[model samples]
Target: MADDFKVTDPRTLRAYAHPLRVRLIGLLRSEGPMTATRAAAALDDNVPNCSFHLRQLAKYGFAERVPGADARERPWRATARTTSWDDDSDDPAMRAATDQLNSVLLGVFTQRAQDYLATRADEPAEWRAAAGFGDMLVHVTAAELRELTEQIEALASRFDDRAADPAARPAGSRPIQLIQLAIPRGPVS
Candidate 1:
């Protein structure tokens, strides 16, 4: 198992916050190691462009080339369990980039979910019954919320590692959308 990397530095956060770079990281984090050509195909981006972002991701210490892979056809994977941004002080550029990246990720996943629903609309009743898409509002203490996030992250990590295995998964085991959110109930008192 590889050691987990931390992203506590502001400069590293800024580097990883770029929309495309973040997407690339998320893709690798979720899908495991992949070549630039494959990443480009999955993202609908040019290979060179994706390669550039992958290099930037590598430079930022967010990703690294898998050892023994072809030099010309590099495969990359996320180096850390999490890449986070801390907004202790207002920095307009970093804030804007984070916002934009968040929007891009939401939009892309939303579109993907829509397409999935559309494609499965006419499927068997059992398939339709098994589908789930919903949200909830919850109230919790700050410490409880942190605990919940950590638990969810641990669950995610289990699947993230399993995704790297091609033979261990069933054909019907499609990627499920999991968006874990924790927001304040209202304005801080």
Candidate 2:
């Protein structure tokens, strides 16, 4: 599948705006390929629902069947290492759709974080120590914020290959969910 990071069409954005589809893409990306049944089990949803959403994600180029999987139990994987959308689309409809998609995504992210925090106590002490949670207010210029985002992206890309080759991952390297958000909290005083 051709991997286009920036989604420009409203229809595609709207298609991905669903909660299940968003989580499905995230699941595939993080945990590697899985059949609709496996994904459904992990998500606590029905197989048909998972299959339908996976197809919808595939329709928009977010995911595709793993090449070697059989017709009976096709495992789907993410088409790209990352999904990006243009928040500044020239088309009003697409722009509005993008905004709605972003809102949905923010809600999804919030849920993931909350779930993690709720279960964090059950995790081992090492993991508990390793986890991070902070909501600091930083002062920076627009260019500085851009650079910060770029630097954070670069830092996270260090694991882009781990999804493809589990052997390449160093021992004790565990998957860590990192969410970075930088929004202007009102105008600078």
Candidate 3:
């Protein structure tokens, strides 16, 4: 896994708003280096289409060809451990594009949650025992909300060393997605 985070340009950010591109990036980050043929098989996508999108991803600096693969088979790896963008971009088009990208990401997150819920029963007893779901409605000021999110991020960082080095992970552990959301609803009159 990569240790650095990349900030995207507006055009590149908009390009990532495509659903397949989003899924491909997530797959690369989670599963590591893979050829377009392997990626297409994993996603049930066509190889040529996956290759075209992988090229677009490489063109935008999101992914790159792995070193020392067979001359004919190009294996690609994600360029960054993760990516970030300025969601508060002042430019109208950039802000709109960011909003659209965020919505697509939310859909992906929700779909992952649904998939987990659908198949969790098939998981080992220990994993099923450790899984969870919870929600709360809290009263808080905007500043408090910011502080809350920051604290949560800091806590999550404690377990993130493994992202940069797989050796940092202890034995018997498997990947788990930790989705966080703190949406603010408008005040009712």
| Native-structure RMSD, model 1 | 3.6
Order the numbered candidates by lDDT, best leading.
2, 3, 1
State each model's C-alpha RMSD to the native. Answer: 3.6, 2.0, 2.1
Q: Mind giving the per-residue lDDT tens digits that candidate 1 earns over 14-104?
A: 6766667867887887778899899999888899999999999889888889999876877888887566655443777666655655566
Q: Quote each prediction's TM-score.
A: 0.72, 0.89, 0.89
- lDDT (Cα, tens digit) per residue for candidate 2, span 84-174: 8777668999888988898898999899889998998899999889886878788899889889889988998887778668998999888
Error of 1 at 45 (Å): 1.0
| Pairs in clash, predicted candidate 3 | none
lDDT of each: 0.74, 0.86, 0.85
Question: Which regions of candidate 1 deviate over 4 angstroms?
Answer: 1-3, 81-111, 114-127, 151-161, 166-171
Q: Between which residue pairs do clashes occur in model 1?
A: none
RMSD of 3: 2.1
Q: Top lDDT: which candidate number?
A: 2
TM-score, structure 3 vs. true: 0.89
lDDT of 2: 0.86
List where candidate 2 sits over 4 angstroms from the true fold: 1-4
Better of 1 and 3 by lDDT: 3
Which candidate do you rate higher for lDDT, 1 or 2?
A: 2
Model 1's TM-score against the true structure: 0.72
